[model samples]
Target chain A: MLAAARDAFAERGFEGASIRGIATAAGVDPALVHHYFGTKDQLFLAAVQAPADPEELLPEVLAGGPEELGRNLLGMFLRVWDGPARAGGLALVRSAVGSEWTAKLLREFLVARVLRRVVGTLGYSPAERDARGALVGSQLIGLVMTRYVLKLEPIASASRESLVEAYAPTLQRYLTGDVVLPG
Target chain B: MLAAARDAFAERGFEGASIRGIATAAGVDPALVHHYFGTKDQLFLAAVQAPADPEELLPEVLAGGPEELGRNLLGMFLRVWDGPARAGGLALVRSAVGSEWTAKLLREFLVARVLRRVVGTLGYSPAERDARGALVGSQLIGLVMTRYVLKLEPIASASRESLVEAYAPTLQRYLTGDVVLPG
Candidate 1:
């Protein structure tokens, strides 16, 4: 079922792929797909094996409050990429670079599941929040590229806590600083 | 010869691929390859179609002085990636994500060809310089991923100068600030 969903999502983006079509491809009822996966969004999370559950992340990350948002967020990013989800995370990132379909899925997942949920609670206009989110995304994605994918030395071996400390301020500024948003 | 070199590089990393091997694959003498390409570094740059020429970059980037390093560097990067080199640069980055061989070639090219030359003039110990280079790399690669590969909006459509203004400080800090070295 998950494989079918993956195929469907891969062929069509999050917007184009339909729940009923994915269900039909999976040889299951639409209702069953819902029962098993909850929604298209949930199905995607399962399909990509995304470990980013806003529910799990919100409280712990927000626990640090906005002041420590960058620190907590970078630590969590390191944990996810460095921990058990590393392989899946790597695969998804790898595929996303090569495939527009995968890139779209990743963008949708990031904006919908991760960025919006986390930053929505903060008091910024939607446009401002998105600008901030994209800025934050640029830094974090670069961290993953250097540390995990490219495996650049010193960075690849740098301790996680050290990375969090080094990078947190950058992310913090993007998330909370008075950035010059693009008009 | 270029095709042969690209194939050899695609199969073997920068260090692993030999001039002899590439020449043999091209059915040409190694001396002939050297005559045409000048050096292995030059050969790889032509093969990868890299737009980053340190000789061209160093004087321009340094003119901004160390304090303006981040702004100048980001501006240069944006110009390189956004100009006529966009297609080749995109291809190289996308391939690197999928192939370790490509990734290694990229790393060698980036470090030996680009990073080392630009940063070598700076006043820092080998370890400290490396740490700075890697941090700067993280942010720059992330900028590429978001603005180009991911096509994440606001960032995707954001003006080049706006991006430079926003990200310069982060790069400046990584390059010139008193970052806690990863000892």
Candidate 2:
């Protein structure tokens, strides 16, 4: 059912991928889809998939303290995207491009589950946290777009460790460093 | 003719938008479009649009040297997009999304025309320069996506000066910061 859901969502996008389509793709009755998932939104979420609950992971990430925050965050993200299953990252780019609902789902997941927890734990003002969150999100999303979607040259060729070494500090600056104006 | 070409390309996407359709829209001879643009590729470029040659702007930007590179580049970009003429930016994004040839145009304009010149003036190692270039390109492209296409909240609402202040330092970092890992 999940596999069918993935195909339907991927091929047809969120609006076009109806519960009936998923049911038909899975060779199950449409009523069974309702019985199993309750709603199309839930089914769509299930289809694109998330490896773990970010809410659970984010708190533990911050518990090590703010100093290691960038490394920990980047490392965790790198692990997920660079690990055996890379679908989450690709599906995410597709979602960001596809529909407002998926983009909202992504933004909520990032803000509530991942960023808010980490930033809330930090001793920064709302503006600071928002700025930092935006920069970090931009970097990570940009990295994924280049590495996974566009597969642009050396970036795609870069090893996971190399990427972390190069990028984590950029994240760290957003996380902690003072903002310096361009001269 | 140009108006028909633009609408067809924008609506149907590059592959889907045909010269015949454009001709039909324009109420002109198809041979006229062919005579004017020469090929579909050239027509796509015409449809996508390019700004004043980055080459023309590069010398002025680099005149202040590396110290002010970030400010100049980001400022020039914002001015271009915010000015009376932003159809070019819109065309660029539309083409980048819609067609490979158009993406090549973006790469040439973005990577070769804009980034390579700026990074070339900087003295980073080839590998480092490439990575840095990608980061800058991603941020700028991401800015266009957020500000122009997706019309996301804070970014869309952000004043030009506010955005320049917010983004310039990140661009500066990508341009010349030592790639250090978080402690």
Candidate 3:
């Protein structure tokens, strides 16, 4: 089922891949798939070995509210990557870089499972919200790649709060500042 | 020689790895290596399959002087990734993500061959300069990873100028703004 789910997600993305279709590909009943994973997002998480759970994480991460959204999001990201989620997160990143299929799955997971939910709470127009999400994604991806994968100096060794304090403003701007929207 | 260059670089990094050592590993004279590759930078470029040449690029990239540095740099980056350098750039990124050695080599190249020279022209404390470089690296890595590798929407499809206009601030801020220096 997991393999089938991965194949489905990789081939069709989150919006295109359906629970029923995934079940059919896996040779399992649709009810069993739902019973096993709860929702499409949950199943996608299982398929990709999700680094963190958005459902459980989004509220806690956002509890600091709008002003601290950037700090909280960045801090939460630092924690997730620093802990046990490190290995799985590394694996997903590694796989994504090499394979287009895996990259799409990773994209679907980030956009559908994570960024959209985080950006949804903001009262911006849909277009503004999406551009914000992409900006946020770019910074996070660069930070993670350098600190964890490349282990770039000072950045890799910097304390989490220190990084959060130093860098959170960049995120804050992207999330809530008067950023230029796409034409 | 290229394989030997890769090994030496991956193990000892750009500064640490010498032509003599690479040549020794390849069972050739140091002069022969230098004769063929010209300089250590060129050798490293061939070894890693550099997406673009810094020597050729830095002058034009930084020609806008300090005021327009961010815009010029980002514009240059978008052009490089959107052109023939795209495949080699993608290959290097993919390999780096999966291998620690490759990641180290990448860090060394970015720091020694590119960032240091770019930052050196400005008069600042070494620590301040280093921090700025790291911050710039974080954003550029993120942009390339998403725009080219992951193909994150709007970002991937965004008009080059729109992206440059939207993103140059982040880079400019990191480069010239009063960024918080590490203690």
Which one is best on TM-score? Answer: 3
After aligning candidate 1 to the native by TM-score, how far in Å is the CA of A155 from where it should be?
0.6
Model 1, span A31-95: residue lDDT tens: 99999889787888887667566557667888878999989888888888888878888888988
Per-model TM-score on C-alpha atoms: 0.87, 0.67, 0.95
Q: Pick the candidate with the highest lDDT.
A: 3
Q: Model 3: how far is B34 from its true place, Å?
A: 2.1
Q: Using DockQ as the measure, which candidate wins?
A: 1
Off by over 4 Å in 3: none
TM-score of 1: 0.87
Report chain B TM per candidate: 0.84, 0.69, 0.93
What is the model-wide C-alpha lDDT for candidate 2? 0.68
How well docked is model 2, in DockQ terms?
A: 0.13
Model 2 TM-score relative to the real fold: 0.67
lDDT of 2 at B54: 65
Writing each residue's lDDT as its tens digit, candidate 2 over A118-173 gives: 76777777666756676567667667656665454466677777777877666777
Segments of candidate 2 deviating more than 4 angstroms? A1-52, A180-183, B1-52, B83-105, B123-125, B149-153, B180-183
Residue pairs clashing in model 2 are none
The CA lDDT of each predicted structure is 0.83, 0.68, 0.86
- Model 3 Cα lDDT, one tens digit per residue, B32-138: 99899999989999988887898798999788898898999898888988999888888888888887778877888888877777776778778888778888888
Quote the positional error of residue B21 for candidate 2 in Å. 27
Superposed by TM-score, candidate 1 places the C-alpha of residue A105 at a distance from the truth, in angstroms, of: 0.5
Which sections of candidate 1 miss by over 4 Å? Answer: A1-30, A51-54, B1-30
